[model samples]
Target: MSLNHVRPWKNIYRRTSRQIMVGNVPVGGDAPIAVQTMTNTDTADVAATVAQVQAAAEAGADIVRVSAPDAAATTALREIVRESPVPIVADIHFHYKRAIEAAEAGAACLRINPGNIGDEKRVKEVIRAAKDHGCSIRIGVNAGSLERHLLEQYGEPCPDAMVASALEHIRILEDNDFREYKVSVKASDVFLTAAAYQALADATDCPLHLGVTEAGGLVSGTIKSAIGLGNLLWMGIGDTIRVSLSADPVEEVKVGYEILKSLGLRHRGVNIISCPSCARQGFDVIKTVEALEKRLEHVKTPMSLSIIGCVVNGPGEALMTDVGFTGGGAGAGMVYLAGKQSHKMTNDQMIDHIVEQVEKKAAEIEAAEAASAEAAE
Candidate 1:
């Protein structure tokens, strides 16, 4: 049973938007908020870019974006899209030709600003290519790269300016009879990102792609994204999300899932609820969790595990998780399965034991779900 079932207040009333397919994966219309990350590799290096995309897909990325800044990159995109396990979004800047080339190369989506892709002729050519190739477009509006007119009008890159820029780009797509698209209004500042998204959410029914652009390196970026994306998601604004970090794309996928998991919006793998160890901890809590995380990365089952330091709040937390370990006296801990004290194990052997238990529990869950579906059929 989900916590939301028992606690109605936990429900996030998601905003309804028209769904669009990014390759086979669905975005919007109550679909899972797709997680996205961009590869920093030279797009011309097909092997390297494809490897990065695969790594991110294995880590649960629903979509991956690769830059197609030039003709060479767009040519390489053909092979990259062929080999990629998840949807490939070709990132295009001011060059409309790259947009057309990427669409021809089998990109699932094109990330372009219709306003920046030269005059109406170039924009229409890009739009026609996208339509001919069944590619969705993403109108990404960033505060740092706001149009000069918008900047002059608003006198700054504010929420209003960002929203206006996005609306202008959206108007171009709408004018071109392109509705198979999503929009994003991003900023490095959390307040601006959240405010723009909030305003945009009210202004249009298009599926939103949420992000805080240029959000620094791993730690700082994750924090900024969690705050910015987290708030908008809580308000039922986003339809898909990308956590912009200066780290590896795999890290971005992991962080994106973690954010969605924290909000109970989406779940994948083990959702660990471990405590920061204190002096009262019977086992090495930090090390144990680190080992468990790496060991259980292969488990794609959505489940929770609580590793609490002591009885202070251990048993209480254990009661809610699918599997739990609570520290106790004499270098031993209690293993709780399905919220019941099932057994005890020494600290030295607990990590392996916990892994085994979680794997067993996940298999059981999968089997039961399969049986239920079979019965329905």
Candidate 2:
């Protein structure tokens, strides 16, 4: 049962979009928004790139992208694609040949612009390669990298200019009879990103990929992406998302899931709801949360955990979460399971005990889900 069914105001009506496949994963339509991250390693080094892709996949990336710059990079993409747990998107910029190579190398999708691929002949060649190799294309238009003619006409990187650029790119693909593609118009500015994506959403029914390009470091980027992507997602404008942070690719995947989870759009792994520690805390709330976060990273079950500092709001918060711990006197805390008071334990045993409880709860959830699936089948 969905909470939105009871609270009508909490529901988000998603924008309608045609569905496409990035390998086995579905995008647009009723598909859960796919989370993506790009590897920063040199693509020529197959070992490093494959390891990075696997790490990001482990962190819950539905799709991972790698740069296929030169011949060397595209050559290595073959092995990387074969070994990757998730679908691989080959990022090709200013190189038509690289796009062809990547498509032949088994990239699930090719990230490129048809307008920039030399001439119409070159564009057709790349599109043909995509069709031949069953690769979908992503027409990514960044505000900072718009065409010179568009910049001249608009006199700036505005939403209108971004949308115009994306439409033009879309036209090239349409002209070539290619429709298996998704689109993204990204900018570093949150306002610009939101406006561009919203405009694009109204313009076409194609799957929209959301991202605020070059969104700073971990802290700043997460906030910017949350604000920009969050608003767009709330309005139901995005079909997929990538949190472009200047951090590890795994960090990007984690942030993407967090954004989706916050909106109740998608759920995977444990969702920790911890309060900001105050003087009322009976134990080290800050350190305990940090430890729990690391310890529970391996649990991919979708559920909630609350760690509150004091009894003031802990009980209320616990009533809604799957597992919870509220601080109390005498260096002990009250534990809640399935949103009900379960037990009390000293602070020393709390961390290990919570970890054990979370793991057990995750297993139970998985088993129930398996049973439900089997019963339905």
Candidate 3:
């Protein structure tokens, strides 16, 4: 049972939207909110790009987007698509021909701004290619790249302008009778991004791709994305998310999952609930958590662990997690398993011991899940 079941206020009521497929992964409706990231490598560099895509996929990316700026990149995209474990979305900009080439190259989806991809005739051709290749389209509207007319009309980029840009592109797809599409209205400003997404949510039933575009380096970008994406997600507005950071693409996937996990919208590895240590502590809470995080990265079964420095709120927090260690006197602390006080362990042995316990619990959960699935079959 989830904590949300007992606390109604914690529940998030997602907006109703039609579902679309990006390869085998579903976006929108009742689907698990998908996490996505783009490759930083040159698209033409098949080996490096493939390596990054595989790494992101192994880290839990639902989909990976690769830039296809020209013919050579689209040609290389063919190999990347073939090599990727997850779906590939070809990111096309200002070139309808590149969009067509990407669709024909076995891309599951194309991320393009319909307004900027030449005229209606070009857009129709791209849509035809998408339909023929069975590719879904993503209408990406960024604040930095709004149409010249929209800038003239609105005087500057704002939430209204971004939403207007999205709707205009959406109209092109709809005019062509193409419905297999998602849309994103993104801005670097968190406020503008949230407001634009809210307006877009009400204006269309298309799945929304959420992001705070060009969000700074790793630390600053993570903080900005978490605030912007977190609030929108809490409002039940996003279908898929990409964290745009000037960092490794794998970090984007990790941060996207972290945002979803914090909102209880998605669950992946261990969810550690730890307290910041103080003078009353009995163990090195910060160092212990850092070690546990790296050591337990391979545990995919969703669970919780609590590591508290002292008994202030230690025991109380332990009661809610799958495994816990609450610091105490005499060089040892109490260990709780399955939310109950189980035993005591010395500080020196706690890290390795907790890893073993988590692994055991994960295996048990997997076995039980397999049994339930087998019985259902």
Candidate 4:
């Protein structure tokens, strides 16, 4: 039984939206909310860009975006797309021609800022190119680049203005008889972004791509994105998400997955639950968790591990996790497997021992799943 069924408050009723394809990945209509990231590497550097895309994919990104700022970038995109482990989204700005080129270069989606992509005729051309290439479009409306007319009408970037801008772009695509698209109304301010997305959700049934744009470096960006995206996701508004951080694309992917995991919307690697160590700790809880995190990075199996410092709440927490370790006296801790007290280990050997146990448990889970699948087949 799922936790949501037993705990009603954990339930999230997602908004109904039309499904669109970004290559082979579905964006909405009951599909898993896809996590995405954009590469900071120069798109013209095919090797570097492909490496970044692969890294993000390994970290569980469903889609990766690369800037196609010029003809050279789009030219390089052909090879990047060919080599990418996940679908590639070409991020295009003012140049509609770049969008056209990107579509032809095997991009699964073209992320174009509608406000800056010239007049209706140019948009129509880009739409036609997207259709010809079986590529989807993303109408990216950012607060920093709202249409001049919209800014004049609203006096500033607000939720009303953002939704209006998105609607205008949606109409252009609809007018061109194109519907394979998603939309995002992003702002740096968390409140503004959340408000814009809420209004966008009510205004259209298109798949909404969520993000807080220019969200800052790793630490700041992760927190801002967690709050903004977490609220929207809890309200069941986003179809896909990107954690915009001024860090490596892989870090963004990791943060995106962590947000999804926390909401119980998605799960991938080990979910570590640890307490901040106090004097009550029998072992160096902080160092042990840090070491375990680094060691368990290669474990992609979805599971939970609790590294509690003391017995006060540790045993209770251990009962709910797949694998757990609770600190005790005499320089040792108790290990719990599958939510039951299993054994004990010295603090010095705990890190390596826990890593071995986690790997073994992951293998068991995978094997059981495979056996069940085979039986069904």
Candidate 5:
């Protein structure tokens, strides 16, 4: 491809204001889309907690959050924070002391819902410790556990109600001159969560941490998160996102990236476009696509790759993407690159051939981009 064919990828959306650091990772204000997940392991288990944090980091989490409910978990935070590959976020609920202990233990950030922490004096104490430790905080307000006063006043967890709750927490932080923080008002219902986030986005510039709270296991959770986070992301409303699935936290990271990729907001791994199985499908497309997706887990490039079941739509779909393969007769398929036929190969050869082509083409594209950037500079 020539320079004339290169189109600029401009993300014109208005990013939220405020700047907070989770270790070395910057959240909000034009930073790259950050991937975050919480560890499900017991926080008091030092070894287990450290292991899970490391696992999350290896799986590409930029920030790892762990719940510290007691004094033992508070003590464990020191070692966990020390050993973590990425920044550790100490998640504290209903306990202001744990937040202080987490900050003292060198946690990079603290996740606390201000309304749940109680009293102006206690809040200031946590904030003082956080400022002393140079740690950031996340004001995480959930609909299921909104303040009783706010709930009684609003009569329900509506969007306006959620926004009111978030603002109330924001006021608490602002009252103490604590600006190193982010906010999230999450509800289990997708539409309600999206609406709440949208309202908050309009009201303030704090980096909004997005999620569909208490979103259930694997399939259902993924769908709920995709719907809620995806909608807010499409409107340019989120900064860092966590897909709160009941499944493995790694899956949360994966789904978070997928939402970003789908919105053309960011790209991480393979972008696979495959057809739904039909009578015209010549090969095991469902199996092939699933296997290909799992196999290409580590390919982190902005490359569009397609796997098609039949020639009718395959070649055209492949042409529309960066690389693709279409089914052909007698256990064979045709591979297309940049919309042109590269070669015809056997069904078994399909995966390897497409992967090789993608890697090679990706290198070429990267080199071209570098050269263009240099010329511009």
Candidate 6:
């Protein structure tokens, strides 16, 4: 394709409400779309919880949520909060006391499914405690369990019912003069969840936390979450997202970023554009792309790179990326840099050569960013 033929990138986005801070990282308003994950370890186990929290942080999770189920779990919060690399969210259920305990223990945020958390007075206490501790709250209303009155009114856990439930919870907090919070109305069913969130988005300006609850194991879960969250995000509905995979929490963070990237919302790491192999593939496309991906797993750059299997589509794709390789003729590949042909290398040298070039480009980018930061300072 010629330069003039290149299609202009159309804006496929709806303006998200706005960004709001969840701790330091912004969730909805104008903040970068944050990637959040939950710790599966027992929250009272300080070492394991801290380790998991740190692991999620190291794995690029912008925030980590852990369950504070009991008084012991609340006690562990102080230490866990002190050690967490990113702000910590305490997931409290049913127990208003635990919410207060978590708030006092230094949780940056508290996540509670308000429908199940009991009376208005208790809810008010939870809100007051959060206000006292400078903590935010998430009124996470789930489809699995809803307020009995709503269930009777709607007959089943429908989108309208869920939205109503979420509003009721939001009303409680707002009436109590507590406004520093986010909301999530998650349903195991993607359609229901997405619809509910869209409805809620209209009814409130509070930032939304997107997820497809009980999203099954890796493959199905990621797909469901992507489609559900991605659709809303494309419509400018979500502020922060959690890809609730039944796999490792780290994988959740990875998939969260992937969804954001697919929507052109954010890019945190190497965005590898690789083609599926055909007989035309001159090199081992799978192995090379996999190797490159694994090696650059920790490289936190927003640069796009292409690793194509064959020469036919390679050049076009490579030209669209910041850097890349085009495979052709046995054991040979051409490198593309800054949308132009840079050089050619043999198959065996591909990985090393690509890595070296990427490292150099990344360093240059980092240096430029540092210089910009210093100039701003």
Which candidate achieves the best lDDT against the true structure?
Answer: 4
Each model's lDDT comes to: 0.91, 0.91, 0.92, 0.93, 0.85, 0.86
lDDT of 2 by residue, 141-195 (tens): 9887888888899999999999998898788889989999999999999999999
lDDT of 4 by residue, 34-70 (tens): 9999999989999988888999999899999999889
Q: Give me the overall lDDT of model 3.
A: 0.92
Better of 1 and 2 by TM-score: 1
lDDT of 5 by residue, 8-126 (tens): 56343755677778889999998877889999999989899888888777767899999999999999899888888899999999999999999999999999986688877898899
Best of the two (1, 6) by lDDT: 1
Error of 3 at 105 (Å): 0.9
Clash pairs, candidate 3, are none
lDDT of each residue in 99-188, candidate 1, tens digit only = 999999999999986446677778788889999999999988888888888888999989999888888877877898999999998889
Shift of residue 58 alpha carbon in model 4, Å: 1.0
Q: Which scores higher on lDDT, 1 or 5?
A: 1
Q: Which regions of candidate 4 deviate over 4 angstroms?
A: 1-7
* Candidate 1: pairs in clash: none
**Candidate 5 stretches greater than 4 Å from native:** 1-12, 365-377
What is the Cα-based lDDT of residue 310 in candidate 3? 98
Which regions of candidate 2 deviate over 4 angstroms? 1-8
Q: For every model shown, what is its TM-score relative to the native structure? A: 0.97, 0.97, 0.97, 0.97, 0.92, 0.96
Looking at model 2, how many pairs of residues clash?
Answer: 0
Model 6 residue 337 CA deviation (Å) reads 0.9
TM-score of 6: 0.96
